[model samples]
Target: MPALPTAALQLAGFLMAHAFWTASDLPPGGHYQPQSLCMRADGNRVLNSFDGTNPKEQDEAARAFVTGGAAQWPDCAIARQVKVGTPTGDVDALVIDVVQYGGSVMTVVQAFRPADKGFRLLGDELMLGDNGPLPPLPAAQAAAAMREGALDHPGMDGKWNQWETERDPVSPLVER
Candidate 1:
């Protein structure tokens, strides 16, 4: 059988996780609202989907979320791929670059694998700027960084705030 598109599978897993987390409503401190899914020009949906007044309006909002309803640069794309050695095994990693019109670009590095009837998000890092085509680091170095919890880099700060977000529970690329 053919494998599913990596991007779609990963996004679906992410959306599912978001849904699970929101529904669980753990910690009970902050407001947790479910997100809405909308397709983008690149055939991908917005990461932060939200509820809209109506289905049609929600669709429009999703479209506008990516384009701002104005002529802009093309949608996001998978800039590059890299291989990393994880505890489970060697896996393919992807670097996704999203360009926001009239705003800064957001880069995401994530490692995923097909699991639990879908996909599992092993590790992810978000950063600002167009840092496409990031070369894969040496396996030894990558493993060391993962062990040391050294995922964030200096001078890469932006609104997304890599430092603020929690790191993945497990190091997907680190071989035990």
Candidate 2:
């Protein structure tokens, strides 16, 4: 056997890497969804400069905060906003959805209220798999939606199962 040339070895490695990446169901950068690449949060806390008077500013601020939060999941993440009619007015509620390689999709549903400064975090819930884009709604409507399964997270219905077949599970807890 003879030693391979350095250039040939490097080219072979590069080709293998490229092939593995191209064959996977990941974004080009193997980081996140291109559509979800909005303004990232400064850190864990999202400070929006919006005055809450203008709808456009409020939406921009909300999206920025959501994107920042979703940044924790570098592999793949998405943010969603849902309008819930409240007694005061309509508010933009945000959800951060993240899916890791060979893991279940996780979601963090959050509700925020406008504060004197910017916005105040009201509450958030962690849900397994694309279970919701749930916004703060009336108790009756929320309950009924949950009961009737009307609130099932839309899209990517069986895509996870397909991915499972293509890749190994991240952990033993993942569905077999």
Q: Which ranges in model 1 have alpha carbons more than 4 Å from their true place?
A: 1-82, 85-89, 101-104, 115-118, 126-168, 173-176
- Candidate 1 all-Cα RMSD: 13.4
TM-score of predicted structure 2: 0.28
Off by over 4 Å in 2: 1-74, 86-89, 102-104, 115-118, 126-176
lDDT of 2 by residue, 41-148 (tens): 331212123234554555465455444543453233334444556565665344443433223234444343322223333332323334444333432232232223
Please report, in order, the local distance difference test score of every candidate based on alpha carbons. 0.38, 0.33
CA RMSD of each candidate after superposition: 13.4, 21.0
Per-model TM-score versus the true fold: 0.29, 0.28
Candidate 1 local lDDT, 34-123, one digit each (tens): 243333657545445434665445445544544453224333222233456755567644443333332423434556443232334455
